[model samples]
Target: MSGPIPVADYMRLALAQTPQVSDQNKTEINTNEQGYYMKQDVFGQGGDFITSPEITQMFGELLGAWGIQCWKQLRGPSKFNVVELGPGRGTLSRDMLKVFSKFQNVVGNDISLNLVEISPFLSQKQHEVICIPSEKLEQDQKNLSPPSNSYQQGFSKDNGCPVSWYKDIRDVPKEFSLYVAHEFFDALPVHKLQKVDEGWREVLVDIKPDNEKEFRFVISRHETPMLNVLRTRYPKLFETSRNHLEISLDALLILEELTTRLEECGGIAVIIDYGHDGTKEDTFRAFRKHQLHDPLTDPGSADITADVDFSIIKEIFSDKALVCGPVSQQTFLRRLGIDLRLDNLLKAAKTEVEQDQLRSGYKMIVNDMGTRFHCISLFPKVLEKYLGRLKFAGFHE
Candidate 1:
């Protein structure tokens, strides 16, 4: 308590006394850290890192078009919802709304925008972005200010699209909705497990006994129920030496809930994140000021994330949802007409600087590093006929 206290210190103390801290408890550290966005700018050039939507307007535009096509396939409901999880700075939502506004005839005007965001700081930024006109967005960006009531109960833009914010996806009303989760799942907490002699033990954070202020990764004394599930579900993991596995049970639970909602109602979800379909490597990482750091070093000060295991996602929704491509982001965007959109933007560029900015954004999303990121789309089985044999642009070879 005297010197610098690690974010895990309090939890470690609780675990020492009770010795029964659940895996969920370990995940809370990360979630709580993320919820502290009010104290940090974790997005854009001024922050630690940037996302796809931040890289290019074309990214959001393509997704908006894709969503519109899916809406048509779903028979174009009179009233539907457009939801985005963790809509950082509201850039993607703004871009998507622009497309929706342009194609109002087909997309319809009776749509509500729902965002599941917990951070008050980000929610205000989102409100500002979505509520402003496209033409004024650039000019307003400089003079933008956080609303007095950061926790907006309800808001809307001039277009009459009611915008509401929720802390959890479950709170979003059940309806035909289009969902977008961009780099959302990676932020969810993951439980780290390592192969052990007895079985598999969870990796936890604890204060180093010799250096009370320092934290270290310590294995649990006994195997958890989660380990048993992993052993049964993935026996091959044990075959290797020092096998370390990280699984986001929180992410799986969210997907299950989303799948159920999609099946009950009628809609689709597109998930874009930096991860492989599936892998068996420890991907727990932290970023601060755009540089990687030890995740345990600074808890709330750094961004902690792991590569999503999209293979598990496909398996989970295989029956309930029509799971499509865990395809590469590059292929997905290109298939969604990113090239054509880029060319059009370039032709319209008024200056050399404008042209260069557009090119850099295009390259960032389609290059080798960007190609590693993946996009997966999910919809209920009932829409199969409407979708027909037509493969989604990114999902097909």
Candidate 2:
């Protein structure tokens, strides 16, 4: 008779027919869907998309240099934490650790590496990569062994540093920490809202009755508590008639905890992602096989993301931390000496093919297309003395 319903259609039906489904529920449905990340290789080759770290070694190397500078500005803390949120495959940390290993005398050897990652598959991949020595990292890059099915879960060691995985940032111990979150916030769930005649209503997902299997966006009938809070706190967002808005409460909550930690313990955090500084626009999107796809087409087969609003982050941490430029990624990396690093690598290149690859990767991350990605740094206000009047490379003119 009739063929079985598609997974996407079945999911939409289940969610829509439920007693109550909020915007948050839709986000959870998409993000935590079974076989989403595991079935579809979402990072690097054979995956839906790739990130900057995947594009070039220079990307991670420059970030490593920035970390070293920050460490020095903090007066060379004897024991500090290097934390990375959503460290995909640990490529960035591995590169940074290589740099730290080189300057062990100056940066000290008492550093602990903390990676906050949720995907079991990604965690295993990170563990394998993080344990590889930098000298051999390039050689072993192509032959990455699939993660063992029976791999142990939890803390492990990489070089001299103790590597630990946590489900949430709250699990990380309270310590003077250097934090980096590259392309992390965009994946977090966002609640979409639209201005209404009365006030504002949340956008929800529902199954089309005639189609029965297809899904469509429907605005809520009444205002939600989140809508009321948004109207009161960010009246400017609602100034335009029928303007659509998106907010990531999860991102703000994490920022609140991070700021509190930075205030209590001296440290700096670097956030780099693609988004506008303060401008508002609907940016909900999906990626499958490196191409844009309809977000509602597949429940768990595609990657869902949205542009981050850096202005909100700056506002949240302004009181407790010195917020630096949300400058273009091009400017930030160049100021941090990416060009010099690339030149040095070029000189070391043994083959013309290798040299060409390096140049291509460099352009992919530092060219006009990549400049849309922004970098922001936050330093605790209490550490101003130790940080002195030091002009951070990326943020300073």
Candidate 3:
């Protein structure tokens, strides 16, 4: 707590200070491993950046249709759940189920709707999404001000799902039919390391008082025992990767669980994040209030994240599932039916300028947002055999 603590000790203190971080509990993750600082850092003006769903209802609307369709394909699994991982503001989930308010099933209890998240603030915001507590997310949502009763009210089953916030992934409700993870993986902790002509090196954040007060990145040797465990498990990362490359062991492990869920359990997993595919260079970033900043400069104020590597996910799953293109948010939504939805909204009411603004925002989501953000879907390998004569039947099968 005083001066010049070794990286290991600093890390130990960090783990102690970190609340609601399951990954931090791992002994191996706390030491030399880099990244992974999951906590109550999302939302409001001071917190990290906002997501797509927070930007527009269109994003959530399409995802909703996708979830419902998945439910239909799963024989409308009577007891299944429409689950969302890290449902920020719960906007996506709320907007999605808006169209499913009246869905009826003759099951004993009906479907379970669930959201998995850690932040209590965001948790409450989700109630607004479900029209439960009926509150706006940002106090500002109240200012833009829609009519008091304009919020859509849908009929949902009383046997609703609980908002599970357990730290461990094992604690998530098992056997969920459709799971949505939007802009989630990019925020998960990633391991940062650089390779030299000789071998690899681990990166560490060191505190320094020599310059009055500050912390900085200090490169260390790769042969450390901590690194050996990671490299042993993921040699292909080193193979496809080049010198000075950054690897997201976090992403890889998430993929392992994702594939396992799709294979063992029946459902599709959608991942929307910012990144590119390649055995290329590193991609780590820090953001504060919608602006990118130097992670090294600030200890915890800046939101640190990295490029999501969706390219290697197929390789990780092999022939286990159907992996779709990491298409633009614009193209994917257009295919899933955003234009038609907007058209109906325009036809129904509102002024021409309001409708035009919606159209422009839609374009920004693509040429501006979707171009940077990407979406991918993984359908279980066995699903092809099960899907009837649907459009994706032959292709997925």
Candidate 4:
């Protein structure tokens, strides 16, 4: 309902208004103007939105199963760590370890549980979930119900790896392998661009004057080198018919760094998030409370995300890593044995209500996340022979 503002003035206004980038405030309106992640407001039943980990124990369990498969491929390293990025409520980590423990010792002094969380709020919550004292862990082990014959028969001989918590990926042992990032990539900041009469212009956020209380997006044409970089680095993307392209430099940088880190370390990193396949649209959008809202609605408050341009990613990393998925989460889970896991789970349920909830969770992953939510996986240094030098189908150069 307001007049459109040019992106240049918008960026200038936002930057001039930027409170701070680091240090104490913890509020992102201060830091994120410079491209940093704002702290998440994660909590009990009333947060921004619930993640897959919060949805069902099954998601974490399946990921745990997948991790175990990767670990087996790693020859069962006895001393590696289990790491999760942006651990919210620590549910996924807990669920992951639960499955990991079924195959290997979990609540032991040696295994380290490493959580890489930036928000103090989420980190404290994660600490409560994962860092149970050694004494209590021992007691819980004794109190734990005896494993079913299937678990005992399938994973009885496996040894549990130690756990370690890190605030940054650099802190994770370069040698320690298997990694999981569930819904992590989407939260990263992506640059929005719109081609113009003159040239390509970058989209930026600026505070509106009507009351300076809220922020809105504005596009400013670039007369400098960023335009060059955008044109050169993303030619195919720019050439596409989209009105704008939301570029995830963070995703690219993260993949690049992960490839370098795991090149010598040897591990598999699995990424599951709500996204799309090709590098084709401006999918920048936001969710407030639970429903979708205009992306310009709220800057720091709403959960903002964009559909992933995974084809661009393939172009970037086809040489170093074996990237799979970008497949449906439903499809990936099915291939990874989620159907078998759920059938056993539903049959084991003693009550109707419990069976219904389990069935609902299973449907959430397969039906909703299956088609709409994409899964992109990375097998660094592990799947070279299987994927190496292949033509890399699904995209044309």
lDDT of 4 at 349: 95
lDDT of 1 by residue, 270-305 (tens): 999978766647787878788897766645566777
For each candidate, give its TM-score against the true structure.
0.83, 0.83, 0.76, 0.76
Write down the worst ten-residue block by lDDT for model 1.
Answer: 13-22
Segments of candidate 3 deviating more than 4 angstroms:
1-41, 44-48, 74-76, 102-109, 134-165, 208-212, 384-397
* Local accuracy by lDDT, each model: 0.73, 0.73, 0.59, 0.61
Q: To one decimal, what is the Cα RMSD in angstroms of model 3 from the true structure?
A: 8.6
Worst 10 residues of 4 by lDDT: 148-157
Tell me the lDDT of candidate 4: 0.61
Displacement of residue 179 (Cα, Å) in model 3 is 0.9
Q: RMSDs, each prediction? A: 6.9, 7.2, 8.6, 8.5
Which 10-residue window in model 2 sums to the lowest lDDT? 1-10
Candidate 4 per-residue C-alpha lDDT over 109-182 given as tens digits, one digit per residue, 9 for 90 to 100: 24445666655556555656655544445554546553222111011112333334555666565665667777
Error of 4 at 162 (Å): 5.1
What's model 2's lDDT at 203?
A: 80
Q: Which regions of candidate 2 fall more than 4 Å away from where they truly are?
A: 1-35, 38-40, 132-158, 229-242, 383-388
